[model samples]
Target: MAAQLNHTIVWCSNRSASAKFLTEMLGRPAPTHFGHFDVVELDNGVSLDFADANAQIQPQHYAFLISEADFDAVFSRIKDRGLEYSADPMGSRAGEINHNDGGRGVYFRDPDGHYLEVITRPYGSSG
Candidate 1:
């Protein structure tokens, strides 16, 4: 078996609110309650678990590979929320798409300042 990503742990100041927002934003159901934490599932079977603790929370960058149709739907929702976004992963400016390595991608942030991305192609060109 090949090694693969299993899940990610997200530390949030407002656990419930962050979980709710993320669940709704991802078009998935709210995470199941689990002993002072919640877990949001991804289509790949990996989960994004949330936790609340009394400490400074550093944002993390999580990228999602999506289909064109899904991209359109999610992008529409991003715009509807009036959230700032960038086509570049570095987030140099708003509304910029970096065709780096021949892949089309965009970046945005979640409520807790976690960086998020949607990509239609993988990085680097094979052809």
Candidate 2:
């Protein structure tokens, strides 16, 4: 069987709020509560199971491959909310978006400091 990404747990100080932030950013539907998790389903059928952390939470990176229109929309939302962003993942390039692979990409952090990325093209893909 072909392996596919199923789900991943995103530990957060507030699960529901984190999930809501992601959903809003990606223009996805509101997350649903499930078994101590706030489950956000992506269009690809992968799920982001948001859970509250009992210990210190180490921030993680989550990237989304989206269309040009979606990228524009998400980028606008990020700017509209006055969120700080960077073109590079390490955050060396602030207040900018990268045109890597000939597609636009931006990186921002969630409320819990989890780095979120939205790209119109996958890395290593030809433009």
Candidate 3:
């Protein structure tokens, strides 16, 4: 079998809050408590395990590919929560979504300042 991502630990001050932020922003299921992590499982079988950081937390970026309909729903939630969003990863254009690769996408920061993105299509998928 090919190697694939199993899980990754996201260091934050509060695992519960970070996990809940991810789940709510991405429309994912609530995280389940594990030995040292709040595991947020994706449909692809990969899980994002949230853990408390021992040192400074360097922000990271995470992107998700979803359907157009799901994008609308999730985007609505983003706005309803008054979360700032941008059309680009650098956040040059705020409060706007990108139509890259013929699909919609937006970038926002998690409670821990991790850049989170949702794209309706994969990058370079336009054909």
Ten consecutive residues with minimal summed lDDT in candidate 3? Answer: 21-30
Model 2 lDDT-worst window of ten: 118-127
Give the TM-score of each candidate. 0.85, 0.97, 0.96
* Full-model lDDT for every candidate: 0.79, 0.95, 0.92
Colliding residue pairs in candidate 3: none
Which digits, one per residue and each the tens of the lDDT, describe model 3 over residues 1-127? 8999999999998999999988987788889999999999998999999999999899999898888989999899999999999999888999899999999999998888899999999999898
Q: Model 3 residue 106 lDDT?
A: 96
Ranked by TM-score from best down, the candidates are 2, 3, 1
For model 1, residues 5-65, the per-residue Cα lDDT tens digits are 8877888888888888777766788788877778888889998888985888888988887
Clash pairs, model 2 backbone = none
Give candidate 2 regions above 4 Å deviation: none
* Model 2: per-residue Cα lDDT over 3-78, one tens digit each: 9999999999999899999999999999998899999999899999999999998989999999999998999999
RMSD of each: 2.0, 1.0, 1.0
Q: What TM-score, to 2 decimals, does candidate 2 have?
A: 0.97
Q: Which regions of candidate 3 fall more than 4 Å away from where they truly are?
A: none
Clashes of each: 1, 0, 0
Task: Flag regions of model 1 displaced more than 4 Å.
Answer: 99-103
